[model samples]
Target: MKGRLVALVGPEQVELHEYDLPEIPPGAALLKVRRANVCGSDLHIWHFLSVAFRDIVMGHEFVAEVAELGEGLTTDSAGQPLKVGDRVAAVYYHTCLKCAACGRGDFSMCSNAVASMGAPPTSPPHFTGAFATHYFLSPGQFFYKVPDEVSDAAVAGANCGLAQMMFSLDKVGVRRGTNVVIQGAGGLGLYAAAVANRSGANVIVVEREPVRIAAARLFGAHHIVDMSELTTVEERTQRILDLTKGIGADAIIEVTGRSEAFAEAIEYARVGASIASVGNLNVGEKFELKFAPAWITRKQLRIVGVLRYDPWYLRDAIQFLADNGDRFPFDALTDRVFTMDEVIEALELSESRIVSRAAIIPV
Candidate 1:
């Protein structure tokens, strides 16, 4: 069978190419890709900031339908209970069950963990990524069942962006009446704001883009600050403090990854505030801690780094979206949809900030 896949051939080139499907192995299931969402990490791979195995298929966030099942994988009979024709989202990574981190439910930190795509396969094979027409699934990795009410786009977003945000929210203890400052008004930023709002927090969104600032308000931002009009970081920080009634924000979620934004987050953080850094750390960016000594001693602030989420969070995220779908208006976040043939153009548009969340319909 022929499958269409996005390939990162070099630093400046990403193309959709046709390739032969690999044979299904025992204990694995074949899935037809339905919808794949373009993510920030995919852009990093396009720019060579994150390395991709040469000529490898290049998607990690997607939902698929099971087309075939290999021997030893009986439908609802084997230890793995997925049936053919089931709509599911791939877990994309696996860790050694016996590892210390795995025991603590920290698969991403496991010494023996594997990414489903990109990395070369390891013994007993772990980390299978989903960015192609079809993917192979292994036992012990999670494959979630999508509800009939949820659309393909919702599933795709829940699998990555929403899931990551939910995990970060849990990490930072977002709760009723919590004050949150979200840096950047892009896809992830907007989603973070929506999630924070659903968690009953008053959200303040700081963005440089005017268009995104307007968009942020629609996405549940109680306060919007366009940094372009502000002359100094203190001015911006003051705006956040004013919105929070001089306490500053209880938590700041930095999604821009710019050094200046990181500094601004620290400046605006409340005493005992938590800062969750979820953005990419680009090259040549240095965050200088000029007020660290005073701020650290006075505030007792906590700074946390968020990688991808735990597999279990996917279910929680999906449920949150389902319950709060009406309030969130997640459909508005999706700015464009493209077929597999237009993957490169969709990616370029996303990188240029022309759209919010671009969905790739593989079918």
Candidate 2:
């Protein structure tokens, strides 16, 4: 079989190239890639904004159909339990089932974990990636069955954004009446806002982009703070404080990965408040930790950094979206779609802020 895949040849370089499919190994399954989403991390990797690597297949968030099963794999063509016709979303990570983290259900923290497609040959023979026309899958990792009520686009975004939101909320202890602030209203921010609202928090969204702020309101943000006029961190902090009646927000989820946003988060959080940092703050980037002592002594602020989520968390996120589909219009978050041949264009548009969430249909 021959399929097209987006390859990161070098910094700021990406191209769709054709490759011949390899043989499937025992305990492995082959999937026909249906749709792949351009993630924020994909943009970071493309710009060399991330750690370097040689030529690499650059997609992780994707959905597909079962095509074939290997010798030891018991599934039928279209992969037994999941018929050839079943539509599914692939989890992006693989972990050692016997590890301590895996035992604790923290798959993301497993020492032997690797990117779904980037795993070396020493790991799993068929566990390659979903960016191509057909890719391999390994055992022990979960593959979710996408419900009929969920659209392909919604599942693509939910694979990451929705799971991240649920993980952040769970980490920060958001409650029914808790006041929450989400920084930035991009793809992740919009999903976080909807998740926070559904969790019964009084959600406030802070975004510099007016267009995004307007969209945030439509996505269930109780208040939208236009950060355009707020010049200083102090000003932004004060604005957030004012919105929460000077008690400050009970929780703050930082999604922009901007240094200034972290500074403002530290400033706006009430003593003992929890801050979940989901954004990728550049390494070696210096920001004032002026409130460190106060945060520890007086406020007892709990600062937690988040990474990609566990499979169960992703499952819960899917259920959340499925249940609250009416309240949160997951469809509205998607700005456009392109074919697999237009993978480069999809990445470009996402980087330029021309679209919120973009999907690439590989089939």
Candidate 3:
């Protein structure tokens, strides 16, 4: 079969290349792309803000239908029955399950995280990335059948943002009656708010961008703190504290990808509260900020760093969206849609933060 993929030739440069697929090998499958999302994390690679992989697909967080299934595969990563023609959201980490990290159920930390997608173009499975007409699901990569009731847009993020956010939010304990302070209103932040709200927490989101601030409310943010009006770290922190009745938030999550948001998160968290850092995917971007270590010691706060997530959370993410799909406007997030041919324009708009989220439908 012949398919097309968007290749990252260099920093901020991409080319649409066509290639022929090889015969399906055992323990592998091919997915005809349905819709792939331009996640905030993609912007890092799009603008060369992070480590850019050459001759690879540029998009992640997608939902697709099973075009062909290989032998020896009976169920998804979540232990549910799988078969061709099923729409599914797969895990991004393609790990070797026997690794020490996988032995302890830490698949995200596995030694071989890029077993498949990192392969060269001449390899049998040439389609490594989701920004293509097809995606090759190699052996051991976890995938879950998306709920039949869920829409494509709602489950698109189930692969990354929603899955990872569900994992982090669960670890941080944003339970009923807890106050959650979300820093940033991008997909990660918005997804965090949705999960926290679903779990009965009062969600307060802080974002300066007007477009995102408006989008936050749709994602179940009970309160929105506009950073533009606050104008200073002290003002923004005070607004958060005031909303929390002076004791500070029960949990504060940083998803702004800003280094200074870390110190602000510390100030907004109450004693013994938990804080989750899910943004900051771009490693090279740095800023100098000062905060007393004594504050952490004095507050006795629990600070956690989140990068990737457990594979099963992808299943949980799909089920969560399926169960509560109507509570929040899932469709609104992907209203600004583009086709694969418009890849460059899509990346530009996503980086500019013109829209909260955008979907690229593969032609």
Leading candidate by lDDT: 3
- CA error at residue 275 for candidate 1, angstroms: 0.5
**lDDT (10s digit) by residue, model 2, range 1-363:** 566666777787777666666677676677787877888888877777665333567777877777776666554323326556667776677777788988998876775666555543223333365556766777656667677788776777766778878888889998798999999888888888888887789999988888888889978899877778887777877888889889998999999978768767877789889999988557767876665566656788899988877777777776776888877777666778888778878888998878767887776
lDDT of 1 at 30: 73
Candidate 1: Cα lDDT at 315: 73
Stretch of 10 with least lDDT, candidate 1? 120-129
* lDDT ranking of the models: 3, 2, 1
How would you encode candidate 1's per-residue C-alpha lDDT over 1-363 as one tens digit per residue? 666566666785766556566577786777788878888877777777764344446777888888887787664312246677877776666655788988987865665545456653221222234545666676555667776677777778777777888888778888899998889988778888888987789988888887789888878898888788876888998888889889998988888867767777789988999999888557556657666567766888898888778877777776776787777667666779888778878888988978767888876
Ranked by TM-score, the better of candidates 1 and 3 is 3
TM per prediction: 0.88, 0.90, 0.95
Ranking 2 against 3 by lDDT, winner: 3
- Model 3, residue 52: distance off in Å is 6.3
